[model samples]
Target: MKKVSFLLSASALSAIAVPALAQDVVFKPVVEARLRYETVDQAGPAPLTSSRDANAVTMRLRAGGEISKGPFAFLAEGEGTLAIDEDYNSGVNGKTLYPIVADPENVELNRLQLQYRTKPLIVTVGRQRINLDDQRFVGSVAWRQNEQTFDAVRVEYMGVKNLKVDVTYAISARTIWGIDGGKFGSANRPTQIDGDDVFANVSYKTKLGTLTGFAYLVDEDEAVVALRRNSSQTYGARFVGALPFTKKVKLSYLASYARQSDYATNPVHYSADYVAAELGLDVAAFKLTGGYELLGSDAGATGIAGGFAFQTPFATLHKFNGWADKFLATPGTGIQDYYAGIGYTVPKIGKAGPLVASFTFHHFSSDRLSIHYGDEYNAQVTMKLNKHLSALIKYADYERKGIASFTGDADTKKFWAQIDYAL
Candidate 1:
């Protein structure tokens, strides 16, 4: 309560100061809302619940504004979420009888930060959002009802043309769960995680592509017992670019590699590697893509028995692996994924707007144990109703395969419908 009061007071003072300074200032207000319905069904033999189906209807709202003057700005935002159908385990809701649906009901401050921006340099401080290239290592986790944020300081230097440097030092990570999710250091999913985390990135652009080098050192402060095992250091590089074959055709590609090892006070002493490559071809309004990703394992290492695969606990897990979310946590034997997809953008229809439809398939396997986990099929369609409104329909099906004892996930299916509005 006191912190919220302080943020309000600060904003009021800033609004008054801007007029007194007699400078050119701009204030932009923001409002957004989303309503969604999701359902899930899985075959027998799941761990958390005896029930095989779940239904969840959720709504979220965000309200805030930005106050800015030349090279200086202050932003404050608040977010809230409501659940109409709670027939599912929200991780923090204690509804263990139904399948897991992560979005919970709660409210809290979202973002409050101050920034200084100029031609070749930008600095930001306070609770903010930091999403690096592709968001593979560090991201905002925006797909969830409550997005993740960081209480930290960030700096960017771009004095050299086609070259950029970015760095950040964060003290705490505000998780996707809301106020009802419990405090930091909780055994379950905590609302906050205290840590000494750092991220650094340097990128240069060329005719062929853009090349980037980065290092992420995450330290889940020992006080957070549930997350201590996630502490690690990762160093990686990435290349992404596109080539124009003609006026109507283009080729796009991305390749990334990262190495990870235990860091800070983490009890685990092991190392793993990550590799990913994706290619896409676009001709006119149609697109096709294929990719492979490997979350390497440390099995049979010096002192480790089962082994741990490369983990990206803070990443937007939903965007990778598969939409079925079966691989949110990498298996002990590690995992490999080969996927392909096709998409099309339809021309505007009447006053409705453009429509986009896509379908993807994924084949999953173990990196070391030679186990075929399963295969997943995903389909999605999105339509823009107007400028401020849109709708989405999506579905996913994952069929369990291989030895049932070795693979834990059951045959699962999920469906979703959503409506969004922004202003």
Candidate 2:
């Protein structure tokens, strides 16, 4: 009887042990490295020798890993950049002789997060990358070596078919410019409150398109007094969809509108509006697009110069305006941008998977005063060397025009060459 009892006990132990071992956690590694050379040449300053053209070569490296079991996972990442040529002013380092090169040398934590996901819900906590609505309002700023991240908790619910809801409450916005009061030494560099912000979005899909409504509320609390006064509330809606004109050709459109007003501790009491429209056509590997965007101004027009104008301080401003980045901040008179572009892709070229090229042109003007901001042209070529490797070359040129009511438009030229490896 004793032997039989022992045999049963052994069988039960094996059954439990096997299931426990199957639940072990597994880790996946994430690695990326890039080498880039950037050059900027500009003309038309009041003092010809105020700043010289800049040239710099830089490298970025990042590594991280994710561990997961069932519905729970954890991630940690580290990032660093090294400059081969320090001739350019990195917005830090005090090299004022050269034009600005925003890519500074630094090492810091990139992402660290805990996540839980189920069939209908997903939640993430800690510092992470967030991109919303084409990244117009917020994005990781991946072009820079030190990408931006957010220290916040995000939640998404998708239980209702065709409808989804997402929300984020962030205490801090980690910027690509790196941490403040540190090496770079700026209060808002590593963090931005956007006056204690909250973002909420809801979306529903239909045969016509996907429609989304959003609200972004910001309190006034920035390191810069002028910036702090920029605190406001924005409510908007967006629609994006594709129309199948034929089996081989398709048309796409995006339309958005928003209204902004002072909120929280902001002293500004003016109201402004925002509008955007775009249309595109796609056939095979070729694409063509045209777009127009406007940011309404308040007579009180652009605050930069003291006018009340619509502003998106927390937006991924680089993606819009133009490649020269002359309009990083909207002028006090408000702004309007008209643009067009074309792109093509060739597949299976020799050992490389594909090659892609694109060119775009933009015209800038003030919405309030009808002042011509300038004109810019941009072009890029990209090649996929392998599944995890790619190369790119990009160029941009901006023609002089009257901007900010200044003496004249500053003609600017820029070029970039980059190689990336990812896994």
Candidate 3:
């Protein structure tokens, strides 16, 4: 991994651009920094690497600015990460001996774009970051120091009351793992999606709640068979809302469903289904939720020539399934996750303002067949020291069960501590 000293340089570049383009444009500069320490411990017999523990401490810095001149504007940002200690295996580094730490060391362009805006419609071109809804399908993977950005063109329309429509066409996906074939790399090769990709989303906000409909047509680079399977088309609808039954209590619910099928040059002729539902209630400063999710299987596809499951290859997987990332890839037999969690926001203590804490549990099973996959528990605590600084502590543990008979996943545990400063 290469050490990057561009944080100062990026600031200099932003300073130069904002003034040079100040002819008539309104410009706002953006800068943020984060320092994190992460550790992982995993144990499994078959696929176990030589080292079961990993430790990494890293820092990320970003600088950029947004400029607007009338209805036309421009934005550019740069990102860099410096790793002080790298005792873990970064998949790309062939550090196969230790547990994996996906965060790599590198410097690169994060976002740059031009925009045209009107009262009813807006258009953007170049490389940018895009997030939809809760980021279940498409997201920037912001949890990682580095971000996921896309080279594309996007259009948004908000002419109608309570409704907005967004459409985008992307040529490539710049992953957080940085560029492919670099030191401290990730397991995902190419580190990008280089092909025709389209995303369409329509959302309506109502007095009752929010309703959304979406279609995602994703095509992968055909040059590699491994990447070809990622090509697929999905259509879905989601509903989320809250109801204030009483002044002291509020109830919320989320329900979603989507259908997926092979697309483009994918050899697979399989179709699968996805379903997610959750219900929650807020009492006082505490909230509790219960949910169930299913990733249906293509157990009988002849063209694909193998067991296939409904997959969200582009989703921010860490936010769902589990934090241990054991289910990053849905198993061929599919999966069912029954989960529940609780969250609390407490009064300030000392220098830290308020404190937020949450805990969640998940039970996993095979969706198609009857089999116990595993169980997991996760806990997190966050505190804001001030306006610009925040602290976090999180942990995850997964215990394996019988489903390993079909899925080659492992049991793992992880811990993370971090502090972020924004300016």
* Candidates in descending lDDT order: 1, 3, 2
lDDT of 1 by residue, 116-193 (tens): 799999988777888998888889988788989988889999999999999998878888877866632335588887
Worst 10 residues of 1 by lDDT: 1-10
What lDDT is obtained when candidate 1 is compared to the true structure? 0.84
lDDT of model 1 at residue 74? 84
Residues forming the 10-long window of minimal summed lDDT in candidate 2: 1-10
User: What TM-score, computed on C-alpha atoms, does each candidate reach?
Assistant: 0.93, 0.89, 0.91
Query: Judged by lDDT against the true structure, how good is candidate 2?
Result: 0.78
Pick by TM-score: which candidate is best? 1
For each candidate in the order shown, give its overall lDDT on alpha carbons: 0.84, 0.78, 0.82
Task: Note the residue pairs that clash in candidate 3.
Answer: 92-185
Candidate 3 residue-wise lDDT, 246-341, digit = tens: 885899999999999999978777899999999999998899999999999887865554478888877888999889888878888888999999
TM-score of 1: 0.93
Deviation (Å) of 421 in candidate 2: 1.2
> Which stretches in model 3 have alpha-carbon errors above 4 Å?
1-24, 181-187, 303-306, 403-408
Highest lDDT: which candidate? Answer: 1
- The true-versus-predicted C-alpha distance at residue 361 of model 3, in Å, is 0.3
